[model samples]
Target: MRTWARTGSGLVLGACTAAVHLLLALPVAAALLVPALRPVAESVVCRLAGLERRRIVVLLGGTGGRAEPPPARALRYLATRIPVGLLGGAVLTLLGIGLTFAATLLFSWVTQTPWVMEREAAVVVSGLLVAYYAVPGAVLLYLALAGAGGVARWERTLLGRLLAPSREEQLTRRVEELSRTRDAIVAAVDDERRRIERDLHDGVQQRLVALGMLLGRARRHPDRAAELVAQAHDEAQRTLVELRDVSWRVYPAALDTGGLAAALESVAERAPLPVRIHCDLPVEPPATVRAAAWFVISEAVTNAAKHSGALRVDVEVAMVDGRLRATVRDDGRGGADPAAGGLAGLARRVAAADGAFTVDSPAGGPTVVTAELPCA
Candidate 1:
């Protein structure tokens, strides 16, 4: 009942508003013909058209963006809308005539006119009278509603054509976004390469060199070779571990074989601090999103364990509305900065996958890192 009342009120209000616009459009059209009055006429038509647009959108429930049209388009829209407004006025007139007939019929029956003779005949006449007004009334009501809806649709379509960005503008924006994403991906790849080279040269390469020296010594001294060989074996194992760590940093093998859940589990297990992981996924995300999620979680855990003097860390990963979301929080001495080396690289990696990365760390407590990767 309430909805019906509201809809009826909107239709009435829309009809009245349209009628007023029909009256104003004449002066605007006349002013447009005179060169001296063209500017003022254009401005007046634009303002009035804007008000009408808002009325249709807000009151009549039309779909359109809140954007203003150019002066020429506004004038053209106003000129075109006059016919629609006149039609609305005609609908209102029909409704008024039907209502008048109904009121007169009710008044005559209430007053007990002399010609109303038998109760049966009076009742039958009343039914006929009702049909006389009701049929046209119902038809006019439908026409009014259809007209209102048509006007609203037309207004929205015209507004979109006049105000929406051009195809060239849309393409330009898309190109710029792609360029920025490409640059971010390139920078992230270069940073990863440099870090890999540094790790190999400083850690694994040096260990291999020492292992060679140990083996060379063992070959020269037969008795001491036992202890030298043991040292060489230990060095070789350390080098292998370093190489594995580097490989994991590049891409976690668990992600490919075990999926996102097992990959995150590995990160939790490897983290120096105690980590509690909560992951709920109905189905696996795409491979690209999986890789980005793994990188973010691993990097966040490592940063928290190494930098933050935290007692515990919590990680949550979930798939929501076709997007993979992960959050890592630690109760540590906060003040984590995204501008720092590790976090900056993490941000770039997330961006490469068209994901959002956020860091929140105040001066004195828990630090939170969040990432959202689009899987759809």
Candidate 2:
């Protein structure tokens, strides 16, 4: 590179320098190698000239010469290797220089020009041309190569010292952590199911069982039997609805092969008030995304049915701009607060999936729950 700088023109040298710098910026120096390659290459050329070496020392010192020096041993090693080293160096350097010209030839052809013209121009150019231009450019690239090699050496040593893992290994650890988190989530869901089951057996289920007995006994009351039967029927119906909801919360069957639409339809059908469903989304959404949509809609529908007191509910779902958008609004009651447990859980779940959840429940009867999810 130093020799090239001393001999070449500015434009060519400048390009060489830029390329060297760019390569050095990378993690590995790769082709940025020591001058040793020059001689080894030249040895092949020497064979044609019928030259022979007893043995060749590629270089004088250690690979990068970072080892501790032992003067006596070093002297002995150098003395023995110097003659062979010289022959190797001359052979390789000549080869390197020759290959460099070969490369120039190929480049000129690829560029639709002639190498002879460029070489003539290079030969005519003065030190000022070479020094101020080409040589400087070559030097820049050489320095970059040296610097990159030094950096790679440093990185290996540093990583060894610090015991840092490779990129893939670190990511593997992260995946394991996320897997643990998912496992915990599954466990917590199961626990919640047990609690809901207990609540049903202890609270709503027992009430309905008592109601059934009351109605049976009511048949014997001659005077107020008609009114008693009516009350019992109403109570039983309410308990049955509550029981159905608990199971729905545990799992939504419609979320399977039939997809989100089916699950959503079931929600609307189950709600007490009339609901208009507007679903023009893709028939299938990703499982997690689809599940998120299902939960969010189910929550919104339940909220509308119980609190909004609205006469009609509108549920709209569609994928817009690579996102799943769902809007649920009720005309019954207007005000809803996010701090409430129901909406809060929905918000957290959507956020976990890197989606957006919002509620626009204004006072006085039009409450809209809007959730936007990135399904893609």
Candidate 3:
């Protein structure tokens, strides 16, 4: 029943589409002959072509491509569709006639009308005749539907070829992408600088001021001077540690000295969660790619440890097919979103280096974040 219904629907839609294209094609063809109306008619045809493309995509389940900028490709697509639409219309007409004949035969038998046959026949004989007409009519209907689908598929292929991006368009898209990514990179750099400045001012500067006051008090009270000196020394050491941490966060020196593997190992050691690092890379990637890889792993681990109530985290870095692939997995509560805040920033950072970043965090248990950077 469903199949029959779909067939009926397709036939109707095919007929309608065919009639519309036929009407539009005549005006477009005539307009081409008249120089004054050619451009206006072509523009109208392009709009109609867009409508046609949408119909093919939605009703026929086809990915009809779009022409870049100019309407020449669109014009060609419109011209080609005319014949295809006419073919569909013819099939629908034939199928409709067959179905009508079968319905009329059934109605005649039901009413005992002598329109179909002059005399009334036996029950078996009537059933046999009805089956004969109905079977062929059903086949015709199915064929009509199948033809519509085939034509739709063919049209999609044709449109794809006609509308495929030109070299100029491809280059233009690349330039735009680069421009957007560059702007994002600059913004991220500025944000990082501001954060570092705030951390230094609020944390290390206050500690240093308190340390200086302690040292000055120690000079005035010589008896308790030893205790004050020790306290002042501890404060100085803590300030140094904080400064080093800030510097590392900005750009780890370990990346230059020990390569990406060693740098990732240091990250694992610092993470709040018991992070296990497994890195296997024969050589170092480009500086930019290495930095992006480090950021991806570090951020992923930090996010997991902070948000996920996880016992352990795992980090894996490998070089595969001339690309650096890093994955950070945690056994904790998931549901990590990649669209906003920290994750979104990380995505932009990776994209700036022409790398790919992905996060797979469901709900209950495990979260996985993967990044791939071209080592070449």
Of the pair 2 and 3, which is ahead by lDDT? 3
- Cα lDDT tens digits, model 2, 192-310, are 56658787988688878879887877878858788888888888888887777777776687788678888888887878888898888855779888888888888788788887778
Q: Rate the local accuracy (lDDT) of all candidates.
A: 0.78, 0.60, 0.78
* Model 3, span 1-376: residue lDDT tens: 6644554454456557667777777777788789999889778777776776666666655573773325677778766766776776676677677767667678777775654533464332266677777776777778876876676666667667666666788899899999988987887787677878998999889899999999999999999999999999999999999989888887899999998888988998888879999998888888888888998888888888888888999999999899899999999988888886888888877777777889888889689988888877
Query: Model 3 scores what on Cα lDDT?
Result: 0.78
Q: How close is candidate 3 to the true structure, as a TM-score?
A: 0.61
Candidate 1 C-alpha error for residue 164, in Å: 3.7
TM-score of each: 0.63, 0.41, 0.61
Residue 53 local lDDT, model 3: 67
Worst 10 residues of 3 by lDDT: 116-125
Model 1 misplaced stretches (Cα beyond 4 Å): 1-163
C-alpha positional error of residue 187 in candidate 1 after TM-score superposition, expressed in Å:
0.5
